[model samples]
Target: MMPKITTNRRKWKADLMNRVQTVDDNDRPATDYTFKRVTYFKPLGVTAQEKALSVQEKAEVVKRINIVMDHTINTKDFGIRIGEQLYNIERIWTDDEKREMELSLSYVD
Candidate 1:
């Protein structure tokens, strides 16, 4: 039998963000609640893109990242934050061994 991989290859730090609703001081609805970290992020890196989008003669940076993390993480319920930039989970794929998950993340704004 092949030896199982035990150590996780992670270098970048990431935070998981969940949406929360709160009332403002004026009794109005507010959505600026602080994000709570669910778990420590695993190995992550920005993937190279084949094409860039040009909006109105202006170039837009398309940031796509690949994240390898624990299999128990539920990315659908929250977003990811890395280096002051927020990213949305575009896709999730599990490895062949089912020990880790690959998260395809896209930068927000």
Candidate 2:
């Protein structure tokens, strides 16, 4: 199904990042890592789901977002960052026409 234009409002801005391996002064790979910002996108929509057993329960939070089709994103090397929270791309689905892509993301925490 095509995304509804009205519902697909570009309200949220997110950063597309590529994981980068750090190197030590001697040029050896370091244990630490960083991310390089690939691009910024204003998502068509942002949906957040939080499941909890009780009012005080801390549950897993998942975020789903839709954006215009971008060829630069690959699940193996990229991630999405919204605000201060970083998420791993769990799955990616593209529309039949390749006009849009839906990303299922899981919170890093």
RMSD of 1: 5.9
* Segments in model 2 whose C-alpha atoms lie over 4 Å from true places: 1-8, 23-61, 96-98
Q: After superposition, which runs of candidate 1 have C-alpha atoms over 4 Å from their true positions? A: 1-6, 21-34, 38-75, 96-98
> What is the Cα-based lDDT of residue 40 in candidate 1?
44
Give, for candidate 1, the lowest lDDT window spanning 10 residues: 50-59
User: How many times do residue backbones clash in model 1?
Assistant: 0
- Listed per candidate, the RMSD to the true structure in angstroms reads 5.9, 7.0
- Candidate of highest lDDT: 2
lDDT computed for candidate 1: 0.56
Candidate 1's error at 71, in angstroms?
5.3
* Tens-digit lDDT track of model 1 for 81-106: 77787766555667656455666666
| Cα deviation of 83, candidate 1, in Å | 1.1
lDDT of each: 0.56, 0.64
Per-residue error (Å), model 2, residue 79: 0.7
